[model samples]
Target: MRINVLQHTPNEGPGSIQRWSQEHGHEMYIYHPYQFGNLPTSDQTDMLVILGGPMSPNDDLDWIEQERVLIRQLLADHKPIFGACYGAQQIAKTLGYAIKKAPHKEVGWAPVYLKSDIIPGIPEKLTALHWHEEMFEVPDQADLLFSSDLVKNQGFIMNGNVIGLQFHFEPEADNVREIAINDNQYPLEHNDLHQTGKEIIDHGVPTENKQVMYQLLDFMVKNS
Candidate 1:
């Protein structure tokens, strides 16, 4: 199977998702829509993974809107899509859902409670890295998969193939460090859900986090 990733920035790479694709012997490719404008068409890949970024889907940018159009094309083609953080917000916006400012800027390692059994192997709650100020609403007709104290709409799944997560389940240790070094200033503010740069970087990516991410990837392929 061909799996392609829409990477918004250099820091927010596919991380564990790429590892999963490699281990599963699937063809994986990453595209930088922000830098190169080389967005993939629906027929080019079987599954699409949209990685996180600092930009918002609401921003008035050409590439951002282009990505939304590509997402709609993928949806029309019935291809599976997995979105993370900003990518999740993009998917929600594309689906006519609103992206609102979160009550709190959730940053660091926090637990998200599973709200549905759409995918197996996910525990009741798991600690995942988060670094988003904006949150996506659960799209119409989509199942709310996970929620957190800081954000009510943490994740959602639509049509059993499209999933969106407001947190980082794909980041490995080096990915965390890279994101921390670049996007570290946001969490400097004191908040209940916020963690310092050192804390976030030191926490690393947990084994269970990677396990659940792999489960989601598998579920995407199996259901797609």
Candidate 2:
């Protein structure tokens, strides 16, 4: 299978996703729509993974709209898609949901609780890395999957194939370090939900987090 990844920035690459794809013998291709506008057509991509970035989906940019068009086409074809953070917001916006400011700017590691058993094997409650100031409204047709204290709509699943998470589950230790370094100006002191750069980088990638990501990816492939 060909897994097309839409990477918005250099720091936010597909960390554990790449590992999962390779381990499962699936070919993965990454496209930088923001920088190069090299997104693949829906037919060329067997599955799609959208990575997070600092940019907002509401931005009036050509690449952002182009990416949304691709997402719409993929949904029409019933393609499996997994989106993280800003990518999640993009999916929500494409689904005609409102993307609004979060009550708090959640950064670093935060606990997220599973609200629905849409995907089995995911823990009822677990700490996941977060880095976002915007939140997506859960589409009416989608099942709300996860939530945090600060954000109500932490994740959602639609049509049994499209999954959107407003957190960082695909980043490994090295990937987390790179992301932290790139966004080193995070204001941890402003909120208790936020963590310092040192605190986040030191924890690296938790084993359980990686395991859950793998489980979700496996489920997507199974349904694909």
Candidate 3:
């Protein structure tokens, strides 16, 4: 499979997604719109994977608009398009859904409940990594797949073309370290919605989450 990845920041990369894509012999073409400028036409991309970023979808930027145009074009074509966090918000914004500041800033390892088991092998209770403060609503034609106490709309699926995840399922230890070090503003409060770097490292749920990420990616590749 030829996968086109939209990488907003150098740090917030594909993580486990890169390993999966390479291991499965899938060709990945990465577009660094933040560092460079523009993205290639969707006609050349068989599948699209938008990685997370630190910026909000509402941020008025030229690159943001360009990425959204690509996302909109991909979804309109009914092609497989997956998004994480900021990428998810881009999907929601492209689909005309609401994007706003979440009630709580969710950082580190947190438990979420699946509302719909659209993908196989996903547990009802999952501990995924969170690093964003913005939340998006489920699009009009999409199914709400997951939710948590802090964020109501965790993920959504529209047919097999569009998938949005508000949390990080692909972050490994090294990736988590990069994320923690890159964003000092990301809260580490010992509260209901946040956890420190040491706490997240001590919690060994990311290993499990990475496996679930693989399953979901496989399902999306085959079914989408």
lDDT score of model 2?
A: 0.89
**Candidate 3 residue pairs in clash (backbone atoms < 3 Å):** none
Residue-level lDDT tens digits of model 1 in 73-126: 998888999999998999999999898889888889999999998787689989
Residues 1-224 of candidate 3 have per-residue lDDT tens digits of 88999998877888888899989999999989888986978798788898898788899989999988988788777788889999999999998888998887888778889888677778899888888888998998999988988889999988855789999898887887777777745655434565676666666555578788888788777765
List CA RMSD, all candidates: 1.2, 1.2, 1.7
Candidate 3 lDDT score at position 158:
82
Model 2 superposed RMSD (Cα): 1.2
Q: Report model 2's TM-score to 2 decimal places.
A: 0.96
Error of 3 at 61 (Å): 0.7
* Model 1: colliding residue pairs: none
Which 10 successive residues of model 2 have the least lDDT summed? Answer: 186-195
**TM-scores for all predictions:** 0.96, 0.96, 0.93
Residue ranges of candidate 1 with Cα displaced over 4 Å = 190-192
What is candidate 2's lDDT per residue for 127-204, written digit by digit as tens? 899988889999999999999988899999888889999998888989988988877886454654657888889876
User: How many clashes does the backbone of model 2 have?
Assistant: 0
lDDT of 3: 0.83
Q: Give the count of colliding residue pairs in each prediction.
A: 0, 0, 0
- Which model, 2 or 3, shows the larger lDDT? 2
